[model samples]
Target chain A: MKTVKEGEIRRREILDVARELFVTKGYDHTSVNDILKIVDIAKGTFYYYFASKEEVLEAIILDIVEEGARRAEIIVKDQSIPLLNRIMMAIMAQTPEFEGSEEIKEELHKVENAKLERLYLKAMLKRMTPVLQEPVLECIKEGIAHMEYPTECIETILLLGHMMFDCDTFEWKMEEYPQKIQAFLCHAERMLGTKEGELSGFLQMFGQMP
Target chain B: MKTVKEGEIRRREILDVARELFVTKGYDHTSVNDILKIVDIAKGTFYYYFASKEEVLEAIILDIVEEGARRAEIIVKDQSIPLLNRIMMAIMAQTPEFEGSEEIKEELHKVENAKLERLYLKAMLKRMTPVLQEPVLECIKEGIAHMEYPTECIETILLLGHMMFDCDTFEWKMEEYPQKIQAFLCHAERMLGTKEGELSGFLQMFGQMP
Candidate 1:
């Protein structure tokens, strides 16, 4: 039991070291010997934790995506937050990828990396999709409950997704930001035919959409 | 005279051939011999055209960015379209790098490459900054010209630039989108305490900020 616990702790330490070195020196310049020097681990021990550097990279990508899904779940579930605002918060989680490895960038062009990116995108979209549908649904429900009629709430919801939340073939460099995204949601509300004052409080709660 | 002109033409063809090769086969894999075989130009001709493969790469980067700047300028100046809409269109050029070179990713990290990136960024900003500023300026000008005083045009302009235009940082990526921008614009208009929507068309001009 003691040996097993010690092995698990040591493996975690190795992963931590690998991540820092990979992000800094990048995967190419970083060698097994470099990992050994940094982690103070034997070759056999390092192999025990990860089969190859590529495996380690796969792990990192999964970890980042998983963390994002977790964040999206937390933010999306808050019923007090309007659906539109929550969707924005969830969208906020789509941070730029770490640019440590040009190798990674190259891989993005390849079939395998493309698939991985698609999987991650799908995961991200799933978490936030409900945030998109739910709020608009609630808004309509509120209107209906109050005996107010929206001639086209569902169409409005779909339009909001298309104009604001829809994806495009154009490359969105999550890395090179030079401005903020607040006007986007506010303008979205306006275009959705919601009055400024009524939806103002709702729009304001996005707290910076993920 | 004929010999000299023929030599210049041959040299130009070699660079063009090499450019296509690099894009398809990548820089490292494509060699001088490969370029010679494809262009059917002699080794001497290839050497005459480019001192080395690296010089050709630098030239390609210059051409791509320079051409992009020129195109952006054209789009920004088309007065037939609404200025705000043009500004958003201008943003499409900004994202080209996201789907661009693996070479660029590697280059940005090296000291030489980092300096080059900074130079490129400065030049691109100089070219694109005018467009970013122009829409808001035009919106405000058009609004005030129509007697829309105490307006909230400034916030909308800034938010347009911050949110939709910039998407390159991990912070921007992580659910911390610059949401204050919405409040800043919305309240700025209301705080002016103006009755009626002097700025309603002003918002319309900016199109969708998202």
Candidate 2:
């Protein structure tokens, strides 16, 4: 039997090969056999790591979620940055980016892979909520002492941000995009009890103002 | 060829039969042949109305969307009700109820039908936004003369309400439900420029309070 470390290495190899294939070729077009061929692994070995191609995709999604959570946690803990900016950065960090892989991002946007896209968003939100919640509560405590906000507002804000901004969830016209962003900032300020334009700096971060 | 009225009647007949089947037998379990056999129509007749079973579902969804928009329009146009209450009613009207058909709602909740659920939510939001937008804009104009909220906020608020409250989108636990509703109400108050307890009457409408 292979050692535990060796088995772990084999699994990582399979995932890396499958992720590349999924990005280069669409998820619907990528096959387990193709992954096995690229990784030089037997069918048994592929099955040993993942039951099917869908599971491989799920694994990749989980990797992205974990990475995002890691980034958000670090941002949340950083005290040098202003609290509101850190909170903004922490929330923004939850959005999963494929790093240098724009092709994978484009592939996920295709109609056929919509279900996969939904699954990824749901998974990322589920994992990142708790990581970002503490900082959100801290901001509320520090920024809005007079207001009695419920703890559940953190999740509500996160869900609103995700649904409003995610292209897959709510498709706004190109012309309407800036207006929507401005409204989001206004609502965000109201919800977080920040003064108007306190979060305007965030607009500069995006290099656009509405 | 059938007259235009007869064709429309025939199409409704098929949809009614398929909708009953989808609710009772579940969308995945109900086949095109099942619908054909129950409607007492030939395959060609069924296909004449809908391209496939999926198309039939889409038609059912559209019917629900149109019905919701109609109800919301009536609520928005009622001059007797207060503006905020009308706005709340208009937004709530967008949620599609099967009208004594809880089975269909439960069916849509099943894991296998998540894609259908997503499609339904997307269609409902897209159709309802324009219908509800006018009333929302009116409410913002009448209620918040001091504040300059963006017009795009109508869609953002609707999207936030749907995502936060929809069981499919965010699964709040039984105990967490009350807290979530309170948070939503607070945020809604802030966004609409209403006083804290001005919208508390909304909780009474639901027969519960946080």
Winning model by lDDT: 2
Compared to the true structure, candidate 1 yields what TM-score? 0.43
Q: Candidate 2: lDDT over CA atoms?
A: 0.73
Candidate 1 per-residue lDDT, tens place, A149-169, comes to 122222222323322323222
**Candidate 2, pairs of clashing residues:** none
lDDT of 1: 0.50
Interface RMSD of each: 14.2, 2.6
Interface RMSD of 2: 2.6
Per-residue lDDT over B70-150 for candidate 1, one digit per residue giving the tens place of the 0 to 100 score: 666677788896764555456444433524455444443343343344344434544555555555466556662221221
For residue B139, model 2's alpha carbon misses the true position, in angstroms, by: 3.1
Model 2, B51-166: lDDT tens digits are 99888887887788788878988998998988778878887776777786566666655655566666777787777777766766776667641235635456666766666665
Model 1 DockQ, alpha carbons vs. true complex: 0.03
Quote the positional error of residue A177 for candidate 2 in Å: 1.1
TM-score of 2: 0.89
